[model samples]
Target: MGARNKLKELRLPKRSEIERFVKQRPTCGMEMLSFLNCLKANQFQDSACVRERMALEECVREHQSSTGSGSGRKRKDTLMYHLKRLYYLQRR
Candidate 1:
């Protein structure tokens, strides 16, 4: 009965629970696309896209600062983190 209770407590997390931790798109995604498009339109000339590049860089910097040095879910609860924790617990 004690072992059975332990097994019940060790049940795997639901698929939806894990899926909810999926990483979101970057805040600067639009800026990145704009920069890429600018480069492509100008025959891949870096000089032609300098303004777009600057805008993209600024967006990235702003995002990084807002997100505490760009850790971006590194220390947050994520799907892989959940799985690894369960794996180790089950192993023991």
Candidate 2:
């Protein structure tokens, strides 16, 4: 059986739950995106927000690098593409 099947059999949380967990963990995706959106809308003038955004981006970069599959560069590119789209949609 595939990894997904195994995970299902084990009653593991689905991908959405995992993503939600990742987002909710302190200093993670939701926080970063919130900070970025605030910055883009000129809601805050704090330089710390920029730093937070950069840190989040770095986390995502490292995650993509570490978990990337065959032809790592391709995986990274695909992840970036999806992330970019998600970020833009969140801003809207």
Candidate 3:
């Protein structure tokens, strides 16, 4: 491999893009993207990529099997709901 290629670093996709994708589909693949993105943001260079990638994969698997957080859905009990309730206080 060329020296440049070896030196060439990998980066996570943009947060906005990742969020959009994850919102659409919160698959292991999507979580993988997020994990990698986080690794890059934390300044994890290529040397640690293999290790980090493995961790990413593990995280993806865990996320796929579980709904821990960040479900990417509009919450039902938002401020709008509360505001409406306040504006139209019904007699008990």
Write one digit per residue (lDDT tens) for candidate 1, span 28-71.
Answer: 88999999999889999999998999999999887777667676
Ranking by TM-score: 1, 2, 3
lDDT of 2 by residue, 8-78 (tens): 45433445665665553543667577767868777677574776777777777766666663245543235
Each model's lDDT comes to 0.78, 0.60, 0.56
User: lDDT of model 2 at residue 53?
Assistant: 73
Error of 3 at 17 (Å): 24
How should the candidates be ordered by lDDT, best one leading? 1, 2, 3
Which regions in candidate 3 have their CA more than 4 angstroms from the true location?
Answer: 1-48, 68-91
Top-lDDT candidate index: 1
TM-score, one value per model? 0.52, 0.33, 0.27
Off by over 4 Å in 1: 1-23, 70-92
The deviation in Å at residue 48 for candidate 3 is 4.7
lDDT tens digits by residue: candidate 3, 11-65: 3445466556545454566557755776688796755567657777787656644
lDDT for model 1 comes to: 0.78
